[model samples]
Target: MNQKAPEVHPSSEWVQRIFDRISGRYDLLNDCLSLGIHRLWKRAAIRALGPVQGKHILDAATGTGDLAIRLAKVGAQVTGVDFSGNMLIRARSRAPASLGVQFVQADVLKLPFKDHHFDSTVVSFGVRNFEDPKRGIEELWRVTRPGGRLVILEFGGWMSFKGFTQWMARSARLLGADPEAYAHLIESSCSFPSGVGFVRRFLENLAEVKTQSSRKIFFGVAHLYVLNK
Candidate 1:
C-alpha cells in the first residue's frame, strides 16, 4: 500500500525561528544543497514573469534578496517581504540603493499592502513554509492587480537521493549551520504537493485565479507556476 503524505502546517513562530537561525548562512546552505543551480532556476522564474521593466512587483519570502535584487536590476520596482528579521537584514544589506529594492519584515499570510497593489507577485521556494499555504497564496493574489501574474518557484517533488540529502543535512553542522533546520526543509518539500497536484489543490479550486502555466525544471526537481488574477 502507498503511504500517505505528511501534513505540512508549520507554525508561524517555528518558521520564523528556523529562518532567523539560518539566515547568516542561508545563501551558503542553498549553494551547497543545490550546487549553485538554484540561481539558474531563479533566472527561469524571472523569465516567466515576462517584461517586468517598470512593473511593480512583490517578491514574497525574498530570502537574502536574491530574486528581489535581480528583479530590481532589470527595471522592476521590487518590494521583498519576509517574516524573519535576520533574513531581511541580510537582504537589505545585499540590495544596493541603486537597485531600489525595499525589504520588508512581514508575514506572507498577512501581507502589508493595499489590494491590487502589485503588477505581479513572485515567491521563490517559500510557499511550503507557510502555516497555511492556501491562505498565503490568497494573500499574494489579493495584492496582485487584475490580469497580473503570480509566479511561484518551488521544489517540484522529492529529491532523488534521499540518503545523500540526509547526509548533507547531518554535515551541515560542520559548516556551522543548523542541521535540524535543513532537515525540516527537506521534509517539507517531500510532503508538499507539486506540479499538477499543486495546481489542482491550490490554484484550480480558487475562483478568482486562473492557472496560466506550469513548467517543470531540471527533470521535475523544481517547478515554476504562473497564475493570473
Candidate 2:
C-alpha cells in the first residue's frame, strides 16, 4: 500500500511552532540522531568561512545559536536570527554576553538587515525549512558583502539510503522529539536538493555568484556548499 508523504514545506507558523516546541531538546536530539557527527560537520563549515576573526557575519536560522556562538568565540561579530522566540530564548541563555553573540527573532526569507551588510553569511540545516528555499538563498546572498562567501550545510538526498527517513523519524521519536516536528524535518530533507543539484537549480542563476566548492560529509548523510560572490 502506498502511504501519504509528509508536507515538505509546512506553513511558517507551523515551522515556528515546531521549533519552539522542540527548542529545549533540539540540540540533544541532534547529538543523538547524528551520533555527534554534526559537531564535526559544523566545524568544517566554519573552516570554509576562511578567517572570520573580526568580520561581521550572519548566521541565518541560527536555532539555539550553536554556530553563531562558535563564530563569536572565534572573534567574529555574529548575529544569529531565528523566527522561534523559544529557540531564541534558549540561544540567548546558552550564549555568554562576553561572546558578543546576539540572538534575534526574525524570518530568514525576510531578514531585517540592509543589503551587502555582512562580511559573510551561513545557514546550517535551515534552508530546507524555508517555505521558498530559492528566495531564502537569494536573501542570504543579498546581505553578504561583495567578495564574501555564503556557506550552507544541509542534508544530502535521502534516496541513496533506503529507509533512512524511517530511521530518522524513529530515532527522533526515541530521543524525545515531537513526532510531527521530526516528520517535517524528514520530509523536507527527502524533498530538498543537495550538492550539485542545489547549485544548479537554486544558485546558478544568481548574478556574480560563483560556486566555490560542494562536498559530501560523512558518506553523503550531509553536504557542504560554499559560494563566493
Candidate 3:
C-alpha cells in the first residue's frame, strides 16, 4: 500500500463557502468535467449494494440529491443530507414530489441519526472533502444497520491521475473558477484515504466488511469504493 500522504488541511469554512459559491453551477461543472460519466459511476456504486427496495437509505453529503434520487427510483426510501443549505435547496427544487426522498441539512461527521437506523448509506464525491475522512466513515458506519452497505465515490490520486488532473485544473482555473479551489481539488485527493484504508476503518466501526475499488477515465483518475458491513 502507498504510504499515507502528509495530512492536508482545508478549513471547514473555506470548504462550505466554496461549495456555496458554486452551488448553482455545481451540477453543470460536474457533468461537464466528468463528461457525464459521473452518473454512471454513481449507478455503479448503487449496484454494488445489490437491491435497496423497501430499505432505508441515507445519502450523506448528498448535494443536489442525484444518488438519493437514483436510490428512490429503485424503491428505497431515501433521505438526502448535506451541510450546505443552498445546495439542498437546489436538490429539493429538482426532486420530484413523489420520489419519497427528503432533503435534510446536517454535517456528515455529526449525523443526527441513531445506530442501526439506516439500511444503507451512500456518499458521492463527498468523502474527500471531509476534514476527517476516518471520523466521517465511522459516523456512516454508526448509523448503518448490521449487514448493510456503505458506498463512497470520490477522486483518487494515482501517479497517472496526478498528471492528467494537473492539466485539467489549469484549464478549469482559466475558466474563472477560483484557482485556489482547483488547487484544493488536486491536493484533496492526496489527503483522502484509499478504498482499502477506508474499508479497514469501516470494519473496525461495524460488523463484517468487504471492499472493492474501480477506476474511471484517463490515468485512473477517479475511484469508486464499495464496502459492506
Candidate 1, poorest ten consecutive residues by summed lDDT: 1-10
Best candidate according to TM-score:
2
TM-score of 2: 0.93
Tell me the RMSD of model 3 versus the true structure. 5.0
Q: Which residue pairs in model 3 clash with each other? A: none
Task: Give per-residue CA lDDT, model 1, range 1-229, as digits (tens).
Answer: 4233234877888889889989999999888878899999999989999899999999999989999999999999999999999999999999989998988899999998999999999999999999899999989999999889999999977563588567666657667777567667778877778999998877876657755789899988899999887
lDDT of 3 at 44: 77
- Winner on TM-score (1 vs 3): 1
Any runs in candidate 2 off by more than 4 Å, and if so which? 1-6, 158-160
Residue-level error in angstroms, candidate 1, position 139: 0.6
Q: What is the lDDT of residue 78 in candidate 1?
A: 98
Instruction: Compose the digit string of candidate 3's lDDT tens values, residues 55-161.
Output: 99999989888888889998999999988888899999888989979998988889999987999888887887776777887898889887888877776555226
Off by over 4 Å in 3: 1-7, 159-163, 195-219
Model 1 gets an lDDT of: 0.87
* Order by TM-score, highest first: 2, 1, 3
What is the lDDT for 104 in model 3? 89
Question: How close to the true structure is residue 96 of candidate 3, measured as C-alpha lDDT?
Answer: 94
What are the models' TM-scores? 0.93, 0.93, 0.84
